[model samples]
Target: MSSILRELGALVIDADLLAREVVAPGTPGLAALVEEFGPGVLTPDGELDRPAVASRVFGDEAARRTLEGIVHPRVYEEIQRLEAEAPPGAVVVHDIPLLAESGRADSFDAVVVVDAPLATQVERMVRDRGWSEDDARSRAAAQASREDRLAVATHVVENTGTREDLRRRVEEVWADLHAR
Candidate 1:
């Protein structure tokens, strides 16, 4: 069997090419549920109807259970599938942006957080994405608190500097991880 890391490397290499198949039929029940609850509920492409989701289920306690009912199983199934397919001793580092929101960081072998200063994050969000300050702040706030993220992180990459610096830091960390 290939090493787990090798399997992971394969996945990472092809991740961008992995089409978003959650909306397709014959997927896990959770995917179906997410679609039923609100397709693209977690899309990074901003295809989801945020207001509609908020109105139907995002903000209300009643909707919380409903949301979880659809999302949790899907997440679990995906994890299971990946694990089954992964090579032995593979590190399954899921880049779940909302891991903190879902309170599931304990499941991973390690938690790595990449962070930038609030001012930097806001500036990038606004300048690159055209988000208003309030929108940027709200997006930031909706995730886990910075302190919380830092607290749980086994390793952290400070992203306040230049891209090259961040790249070098990432390379160092990756090398260290692979060396172990």
Candidate 2:
């Protein structure tokens, strides 16, 4: 969706990408995680061991909260800097995965959720990302509920079908955003 939006001339600020930056080696976010969860979460070369960290945090609420505490603020700060740097009146889209969970759904002019059912999400994660089914399911379960996401969504792009279908849905949503 973000890729499509970028092609369509929206300045899309991807929080997932920013999340990676905030926790890159030598960053304070990584330091905090190492302090809280220990050096085991780091690779031998000193980059974050993402899979190890995900395996630790996804199942445990406290661990997830700890990870968020170290990461979200840094991501937010980068997002603010990026938004400020966008062109005047540009159609900037903040592609945030945790808008509902972070209590910032109401902050956007329009919330476009690229929603898929749990089975669809799980299947794609397993097939495309090479994650085990249970791991995919568990990761999906950790996020905001489908209903909660829908409640905040001003537009919903259903991603249950093929890539072409997703592109079409995204295009329609893109049109709606332009209309607004």
lDDT of 1 by residue, 63-144 (tens): 6667556556566666667768977765455656666666888886666678887888899999998877877886676567
Query: Per-residue alpha-carbon lDDT of model 2 for 1-180, expressed as tens digits?
Result: 899999988999999999999999889898999999999999999999999999999999999998999899999999999999999868889999989899998888999988988888898899999999999989878999999999999999988778899888888888878766
Q: After aligning candidate 2 to the native by TM-score, how far in Å is the CA of 8 from where it should be?
A: 0.4
- Which pairs of residues clash in candidate 1, taking residues 3 or more apart in a chain or in different chains? 4-90
lDDT for 32 in candidate 1 is 52
Worst 10 residues of 2 by lDDT: 171-180
Q: Which residue ranges in model 2 land beyond 4 Å of their true spot?
A: none
